[model samples]
Target: MFAFAVGDSLVALDAVKIDTTDQARILRGGQHFQQTCLSCHSLVDFVNDPVAKELGLSKEQMPVWPEDSWNGHPPPDLSLIALSMSPDWLFTYLRTYYVDKARPTGYNNLVYPNTNMPNPFVDMQGHQVLINPNYFDKNHAHGEQFWYRVIKLKETGRLSPAEFDDYVDDIVQFLTYVSDPSVHARRQIGPWVLGYLTLFIMVTYAYFRLVGKDYFQSPKSPPPH
Candidate 1:
């Protein structure tokens, strides 16, 4: 299994490509969410969120998990997370969690240090760790090492590497869409708003012409009272 841990001086967050319009991917991610992530993270602002409807989801179809039982700490709400973080940040963060002995969650992330969050899909992604951090790179910098990685799978799970990448992309897309659910509503109404403005401009132009007609015609002065 080949996996990449993105961080360090050489890794660029912009390199990860994700398409938000892939409806199938987004839906798959939603399903994955139900099965995995919902058990930890809560989408508390979901009451006003409109993206679910846009994604063809119903409230009844969704289930809210109890607060996370891990370490007695409740997981953070995911409502505005995508809005706060960059896509590349999300991309790197999701894929970078590796097994760590010191952490209570038994995992650490290259992007986020000492994070308590455990990788729920670890079985599917297998395990990943950084490559030789001390390899000499005179061409770059003396103290810094480029992000190289090696992923070894002791056991296989449901998804393959490519499928897992798509899964991550969709999850990011869904979360991003959820961040500002009103954007979908705006997108839907944008064309109608523009059409209304177009018609209004034409009507206003005609009205202006009518108002100007008296200016072109003979002027009439009223008699002094």
Candidate 2:
């Protein structure tokens, strides 16, 4: 009997940091997500008056889960997925779907193998096939070694690779914003907060030098005792 534990099969793909601060970009991503991902995924926590206003969308414009579950797996609420999995992971995962005849969906993700969700962007992303789908680890550290998958577009999609990357980046940014809408406000106030703290430190040091100097200074020779 052989028991092989495939530990952390998902290979983390490198992605450039997304700018969640770009409201226009985030709005584009939100709209795109509403058109695409809303059919299966939900963002209950993200749908609010503030968020809608921030995204320049009405309540009706916000995405809703149309179905209870996708296939057997409840397509998981994606409200916090960006936070849970990271923007890089989502950005990579969305673009990494490759054709896999063995899989039920005829697509498998390099970031998430045997995923139940079908490739939603198949038309936009076109067909992709793994170059050399094999598993090997020289160290074989109990499946701890990272698994990498190489892929190339077998058929071109609506968008070119660069365009696709930008598209995916926008979506990732939107998801990141949805995960934490307060980021905008936080970023806006961060410099002010830091400035106030710096000023406070300077004022405190000066006050200590001027007023507290007496406390810190050596007392006058007491009666020359």
Residues 172-192, candidate 2, lDDT per residue (tens digit)?
888898899888778889999
TM-score of each: 0.68, 0.69
Residue pairs whose backbone atoms clash in candidate 1 = none
Lowest lDDT block of 10, candidate 1: 1-10
| Deviation of model 2 at 217, angstroms | 25
> How much lDDT does each candidate structure score?
0.63, 0.73
Which candidate should be chosen as best, given lDDT against the real structure? Answer: 2
Q: What are the per-model C-alpha RMSD values against the true structure?
A: 6.9, 6.6
lDDT computed for candidate 2: 0.73
